[model samples]
Target: MWRFLSPQILFGADSTEYLERFEKRRAVIVTDEVIKNLDYVSDVSKHLENSETVTIRAREPCIDDALELAEEMREIEPEVIIALGGGSVIDVAKAGRILMEAEIEPEEITPFTSLEEYGFRGKTSLIAIPTTSGTGSEATWAIVLKNIKERRKVIMAHERAMPEIAIVDPAFVYSMPDHLVISGGFDALSHAVEAFLSSFSNPFSDSLALNSLRLILDNFIMSYGGDRDAREKMHISATMAGIAFSNSQVGVVHALAHAAGALLGIPHGLAVGAFLNPVLEFYAERGVERLGEMNRNLGLNILREIERIEAELRLFEYIPVSEIESHRSEIAERAMEDSCIVTGPFVPEREDLETVIERVVRRCMREES
Candidate 1:
């Protein structure tokens, strides 16, 4: 038995115009301060002419920021909530909308909590517009936030938190640099790979994950090279990857990422990407033959993922195991209790986790001749 989340996605350059397609009365725009100053927000607002649009600014490092955004929504009472940035922005919108409708506090929001309890008091829908091409919050039901009280990254997901609509306009991606583009692509890649390998994985999401991995492998370079066509392909692929993992959940790569994001002030994508191949190598050594099967099923050479990264993206080259050993235990300890950890195909005991972490980080490490 499996469930999936798929939002109405509009992609490509100028696709942001899809915002105009909605017959909304009033809407709140949830985004970061940086986006508010960009010309893009103005363009999005232009489409919502007849409707009153409010911008909610809550950026990184602020987990409870969603509450503040919700406070504003209480007064604005918009007919819709449009998430207008990356994962954090979308999460803020999802969490904010919930609080606005449910009139609840931040502490009460948890995966076990039923969203039906909120009842969408404003009758507002949600539209997710991803400025960055990763995270795929637009396509998933998971909403992650920083939890300052507990000092961890909260996975506050609800089926209802899934966006009703997702707009994936590549025009919004022109501002991203090679690093952001690669980071975002890796975020999606990690999602698909980890999800496909997770204990909870089912055929439904496996298909999405397989295709997503193939697409990233095919176009990551072209997209990173700033090719408009390839970039468009990536824009769509990221969403597909989002849908895949959102349904199946993810694994150790995500476990480390969430912990790093919560503790070390790293970007979400970087946290995941840095740990991805390492965890995979670890899984491969631990009775995870499925890694090879997944590669074969996708018609790809499993070993080539590393080559693809080096040949396509170039430079980031692998790091040495010894170097990564320094951070292994700390990374594993911080990753405890992560939902991803619970769902991994092979959940490592703390001792095993230490070994997996060391071995993986070692495999991806660069050896200087």
Candidate 2:
């Protein structure tokens, strides 16, 4: 048996206005310093005039951060919680909401774990307002947090972790920096690709993935070049891809990216962007049948399109080959332990992961040379 999950999604230029329609008292806005500086926190706060704002660090969130936010939430006791930043902010808010109601460790919030059994009632409603068009944290049950002590990412998922509402307002993404546009677009592309390739994919996820992949491919470059229409389409596609992956699953791309990002202190989207094509190539080398299915469905060679897109964007230039080479073994080891690894078309052994990482490093080195 399988189930698909999505938040009540409000999308478009002024979707933030939807918040004003609600009659909730005591709302709390959780965001990062960067977004707060952008005045987006104030924009969201305007909808909830009586809300409290909590600004966390603008870096990848950690387990301690979630606990700290949870403590803050407990004090505020908000009827509504709005996460108004990128993936890190949304994830922190999700984990914080759960931690506020229940005393479980952030790492312990897995797919099979029952939060309700641990006194987690849906008392506080979560609304995820993403200021970036990537990660799809607003639409997914997944939560990625850095384990500072372990030097790895903690991939957490629970059915209840999905937000009550997802505000995909294009206005929020309009002023996104160019680097974020490139990296986040690649992250969305990876999600659509990996979701289609996942062993857990269903008919629902397959349709979403295909359309999202098409939307992203059609608009990513234009979006990066500051086309407003393309940017809006990219914004919606990101959420669609997020929904697709959340229902199905992601694969080795996410596994390796999570490991690399946590260990190398790379941004989540940038790591995913760098590793996406390499992992796809690995799957192709192994004769994964799903790639053919995706190709036929899209009426084009998906891998070749990805290659063209990556080349057009000069994505390989962003990652330093030396960093990857120096940390290959650790990345592979950590990737093997990632929960995302098992859901791929085939489960890879540690050596298989190492081989992919090595290939990625070699490819980047060749490009640099």
lDDT of 2 by residue, 1-369 (tens): 887899999999889999996545789999999998898877787777679899899888898889999999999899999999998899999999999998787778998998988889989999999989889999999998888998888889998899989999999888799889988999999999999999999999999999999999999999988899999999999999999999999999999998888888878777888888788888888899999889998899887898788888888888866888899999998888888989999999899888888888887777777
Tens digit of lDDT per residue, candidate 1, span 108-193?
A: 66667765665555377899998887789898888788877666887777777788899998888866678778778888888878
- Model 2: residue 131 alpha-carbon error in angstroms: 0.5
- Evaluated against the true structure, the overall lDDT of model 2 is 0.90
Off by over 4 Å in 1: 51-58, 105-107, 118-122, 310-327, 360-369
TM-score for each predicted model, relative to the true structure: 0.90, 0.97
Give all candidates' CA lDDT scores: 0.75, 0.90
Q: After TM-score superposition, what is the CA distance of residue 116 in candidate 1 from its true location, in Å? A: 4.0
Best by TM-score: 2
TM-score, candidate 1, is 0.90
